[model samples]
Target: MNVLIIGGGGFIGSRLATEWLRQHPESKGKITLVDQAFLDIIKNNPGFECIAGDFSDPSLIDPLLEKKPELIFHLAAVVSGEAEKNFDLGMRVNLYGSQHLLEKCRQLAYCPKVVFASSCGIFGGDVNQVLTEETAPKPKSSYGTQKAMVDLLMNDFSRRGFVDARCLRLPTITVRPGKPNAATSSFLSSIIREPLNGKATSYPVAPSSPFWILSPKQVVRNFIHAAKLSAKDIGDDRTINLPGITVSVQEMIDSLEKVTHKGITDHISYEPDAFLQSIVLTWPPNFDTKKADALGFTADKNTTEIITNYIQEEHIQVPEK
Candidate 1:
């Protein structure tokens, strides 16, 4: 079975690519990674083909469609903060680009199974109760709005028999390796990974701030599980919130203190940025993932396990202070 991973060079996308190859080694088809950069990273591996270009370009997608992958995992998007800042770019890349891909699948004689990586940000604004699949989405950020819109498109297209589409609404992925970027939630990973490596990190939200988080491994697992789920089982909903651990900022810091021998808690300083705080505060802190659980998707055991697993997976060296 062939697979095409859009935005395959990215953090979660790259990890998903590796997981796919590891799980499907006996398969004959190549795993085509479509991205603008980092093609060199996976280009050499057997059954891996790196195509470097913008998916936003209509001309670029035809060749990809011609290849006729059996499965398409769309994880490409301008993230939360950047999307809110540049609405046009977010619409072009996140909304328009996704619509174009879905349309292409509709045109195909044999539509591929599409796994869309959506965000929990789609369920924005204040809510004391846990969010379930039935909760009506009220997105506060442009990024969230775009994701929700595409989610609807996925459902509509699935109902029309255009494609076997499944949307997994992922939570904020924590303990991510590498340098920080424009994503407002970057600090969630930085606060853990950077300080563990003896580098300073910032927390742009208050200590009491609560949000849902999942490990990189769990995120990849969700992608794989979604791909394997039968269309008959997934049904008309077409979208499901992947399970995650919900914790406050203070709880995260407490986990850091317990995991690392050294006093890494001191390394973190909270100076809330209104823009970042505003976007984050609007997001749901927890989800009622009963549907996801019943469907066989899993979450981390707890925050400590999540942190420890990340440290081990990333091979982050603990500092001697």
Candidate 2:
């Protein structure tokens, strides 16, 4: 299968590239990684090629579609915080960019399986209720609104036989191995990631505020699962909520402490950013994953496993006392 990852340079996108190659070592197919920038790790792979360009530009996506990728993983977007702050950029990249890609897919020689990386941010505002596949989106932020719009477009395109699409409403992926990005949820990873690197990071939300989280490991597995499932197996509903565990800021810090020591935990201090807190608090921290569970998708066991996985995967060095 010729696979194309739209945001193949980002955290989940790059990891997905490695995972795809690992699972399909014997296959004689090309993996194209497209992002504004790329890491040498993926760019250097013999089976893969990297394209650095804006996905929103028709100039970039048109030729890529001509490559006739059998699988398309659309993971690019302006993250929540930045998206909220810059409506035009979010609309351009997240909404119009998605539409452009899907339109290009419609022109493909074959109907490719398009795996969209949606977000839990789609479910915000008055979210005291437990969110489920049946729940409706009441997006409170520009980022959430854009994702929700794309989800609708993806479902419509699939319904119209344009592309075989599966939209996974992903949770807040934690312990992402990199500096913070524009996502309001970046702090979720920073609190653990920075402290382990023996640096200080702030907690923007209340310690008691909960977040639905999945590990980088699980996210990659779920992406593969989403790609491999047949359309009938995935059913008519192309959008499904991915399963994940919930952890509060305090719980995350506690898990970090378990993995390291108080010295690491001491590096983290709560200094609330009201804007971030408002955006994050609007999202429901819990979900009913029965749909995802039935479909054989899974989540991390806990935040402890998440942190440990990050350490091992990134080869993070722990400072000795």
Candidate 3:
């Protein structure tokens, strides 16, 4: 399949490129990756063609659609914190940009498979309720609102025979391997990554605040799996709440302590900030992923396995507990 990854320069997108190529070594297909920038590794890698451009721009994205990539992975977005702070940017990229891409695909008339990276942020301010497939989205943040809107659009487009879309509502991806970005949930990775590297990090929420998390490993696997499913197998809705494990900030700290030496979690601290709390706390914590379960999707075994996988995957030699 001729594949296109919209946010391919980001860590998740880059990793997805590698994993996809690894799985289909015998296939003869072109993979194109577009982003604002690229790491030397990605740009230099012979596995895929890297394009530096903004997907939100019709000038840049239009010509890309001309290539008619058979499999489109729409992973680019403005993320939560930045999206909340800058409504215009979020609306432009997260909402309008996506609509432009969908319209372009509709013009092609060759219904391509689109695997979208939606978020649990779409379900907000209902912490007491366990989010299920039937749960309605009442987003409290602009980021969530944008994603929820796109989910609706993707569903409609798929139902109308414009695109074969699969919208996977992703959990907060954790244990990322670099400096934290503008995401409000960036603390989730910082609390684990920084401490393990012998640096200090702090969170802007309460220790008991719960987050729905999935490891990067599982996210890639599930993304690939989503692309492989037939429309009937995926059902009519075209959206699946990808399974994830829920853990509080305290539990995440505890998981790190379990997998590493004592002082590892000691490097983590809580310095509450109302702004981040307002956005993150509004997100619903728990989910019922029975539909995803039936579709053969999977999540990390546990938070401990999540941290362990990150360590091993990064080749970080840590003193075990």
Off by over 4 Å in 3: 27-29, 319-321
Clash count for each candidate, listed in order shown: 0, 0, 1
- The whole-model lDDT of each prediction reads 0.88, 0.90, 0.91
lDDT of 3 by residue, 1-321 (tens): 789999999989999988998898743248899999999988887778899989999999888888989899999999999999999999999999999999999999599999999998898876999999789999889999999999999999999999999999999999899899999899999999988888889999989888999999999999999999999998889889999998999998988888887777766778989999888998888999999999999999999999999999999877444
Q: In terms of lDDT, which candidate is strongest?
A: 3
Give the TM-score comparing model 1 with the true structure, all chains together.
Answer: 0.97
Q: Tell me model 3's lDDT, rounded to 2 decimals.
A: 0.91
RMSD values for the candidates in order, in angstroms, are 1.2, 1.1, 1.3
Q: lDDT, candidate 3, residue 111? A: 93
Instruction: List residue ranges in candidate 2 displaced over 4 A.
Output: 27-29
Which digits, one per residue and each the tens of the lDDT, describe model 1 over residues 1-321? 779999988899888998898888965347888887764557666667878888888898878988888999999999998998998999999999999999888888897999999999998876576899999889989999999999999999999999999999999999888889778799988888888879777798888888899999999999999999999988799999999988988888889888886588677898879999888888888789999999999889888998899889988788865
TM values, all candidates: 0.97, 0.98, 0.97
Which clashing pairs does model 2 show?
none
Candidate 1 residue pairs that clash: none
- The 10 consecutive residues of candidate 1 with the worst lDDT sum are 38-47
